[model samples]
Target: MIAEENFSSCETPFLSISSRAILPHIHMLMKQAIPCFINYIHSENYKKKNLNEDDLTQIYIEQAQILIRKHNYPFNVNGQYRDITNLSKGFSDFYFFPNELGVSTNSIYSVESKRLPAPDKFREKEYVIGNNKNGGIERYKNQIHGKGLNECGLIGFVEKHNFKYWLDLINSWIEDLALSNRNWNEEERLLEIESHVDFCFLHSKAKREEKDIELHHFWIELGNGNSISNSKK
Candidate 1:
């Protein structure tokens, strides 16, 4: 259960991925995420194992299954839930919902998961791979420009310096959806939404509603071409 207390620090313009239509895809993605993480981690230890790149990747993928099981959802280090709060005081690696829900029609709910503060001015941010070391990941934050929106009021993540691009893209998509006055199938709409959203803010799924319409869901994510980052960008 996502507690009320967890949503306090969410940034503005809430977006939510409903659990209805996207539950299956979300489950699949979550299942695969562990292996990906493991592969990334083991990539650094190849010399110790005397393994080649491909061999290390296979080992990492296999180990990822164990890692996922090791730390299931509501993941805790000690007793505390391991959420967005990493070393930084701000929420980075988890999701957020809005503090309030409006009673009016066409109300939009917000939910977001974000990484570190990758500033727009700086094309790259420093990621520490090990103790006292920093590595620069390539900048792939340009995908947020002019992304399309779905029936649900969800916007995809933008590149580091392109928040304005995502804003404009989402707003335009929403405007188009509104003008059409036609309901879109959630998955199709989300798929269509992909061409317009940024990989940086890749949304797994989403839903929004108001008094006039029933709640709905959309499934989505950024494609490989656009998804670049030190941490699964």
Candidate 2:
């Protein structure tokens, strides 16, 4: 059973605009982009086994750009290192431009993608969320906070076989964070950013061949950032 304590009911103005205004644009983009990505991955003769996280990240970046162009959205995609402050340099996977135009103009939407491998017979089914290192949620926390990025979307890719398992595990992890008291500081940070982050999971049912892959996607918005109500969906 999931505990009620594992959720928050705080609503922020920035989060409200993101949920109401910007999210539809994002959803529309994903509707067109995911299929294009699947087609490209399968049509290309490249070796999927040889692609690393960086390689896959580039692919997502390309797909996002393609969709933006197709829709003629007035935004720029930036992948350069953005100086969050004097001491911290944050590099998001991509940054959309025209930061001053929109209901949430003050909020910047950054994209981050992670490729989680499908578990083999011996391992448990779950995604190890972090940066390059293991067990470092702080890295993402710091990035989001330091960059002052009010909105972020995390794209997660996994093999079709492990997709459902990964989704359940991710939800459990969120619930754990909501209920855990091990780190109040981290918990606070989670609460702070939960209003601004969206989690997306993508998978496909095609066989494991390098050229036979397809992609399916779904996303959930965390936190009680909506003005209508602050409830988890």
Candidate 3:
């Protein structure tokens, strides 16, 4: 782990090592910021109002930025940030950049967010593999999102099921897809790391013809007394 420097000098983190080498530390900051992010959004009266993925994500970033400043996380959040390397690749749902100096380097961590059990049938599989090639996991697999980074994030606004249910369900989708699709593979299934009352963390991998990358899955349960079905998990 890199030594924590005095980020008081600047807004971002200090990167004495390579950008890739410093990502693990940045990841830790995100893990700390996420729970607070979820709490802040729900406190804003999400259950009563209908907030789409983008609206919720923007809210998440807004509060996450506050935490970043309060705790001096040496990183900041940007919603719908464009690819610094290739604009043609389109926008990522969230981009985490170092406080200041590291932003110019390659320390960017790109993440895509999706709603679990999607709103409609046509986009039902979007959290894993979308019908329109816009799936959260699919983008990283195809290198359309996290093109150069070795690790990226998949943020799931779990609108229906619990984390345990989605953990099993998403893996089933990957297993089924691997059987027929040339690009999909069984190894891409998510492995649960830990589950809390507010959030769950999982890990997976994305492999393709060219290369593979590690994927960190974070699911935040937002349903209010509203499990379509019930499970203790």
Against the true structure, whose TM-score is highest?
3
Please write out the lDDT profile of model 1 over residues 171-218, one tens digit for every residue. 454445446644322222222322323222223132223112121212
Model with the higher TM-score, candidate 1 or 2: 2
What local lDDT does model 1 show for residue 41? 40
The predicted structure with the larger TM-score, 2 or 3, is 3
Would you estimate the TM-scores of all the predictions?
Answer: 0.23, 0.54, 0.83
Q: Which portions of model 3 miss their true places by more than 4 Å?
A: 1-14, 44-47, 101-107, 225-233
Best by lDDT: 3
**Candidate 1 RMSD computed on C-alpha atoms after optimal superposition onto the true structure:** 19.1
Write candidate 3's Cα lDDT for 1-233 as tens digits.
Answer: 99988966655545655557657766676677676666655564554455777776787778777777887765667888677665427678888876656346432788888877687777778888877688888888777898878788978878776888888888899999999987888888899888888888889989966778899987887756222222211
| Each model's backbone clash number | 10, 1, 3
Model 2, range 38-99, lDDT digits (tens) per residue? 55554535423344445555665688787787777645455643544433344555545443
- Give the Å shift of residue 86 in candidate 1: 38
Candidate 2 local Cα displacement, residue 167, angstroms:
1.7
Give the whole-model CA lDDT for all candidates, comma-separated: 0.28, 0.43, 0.75
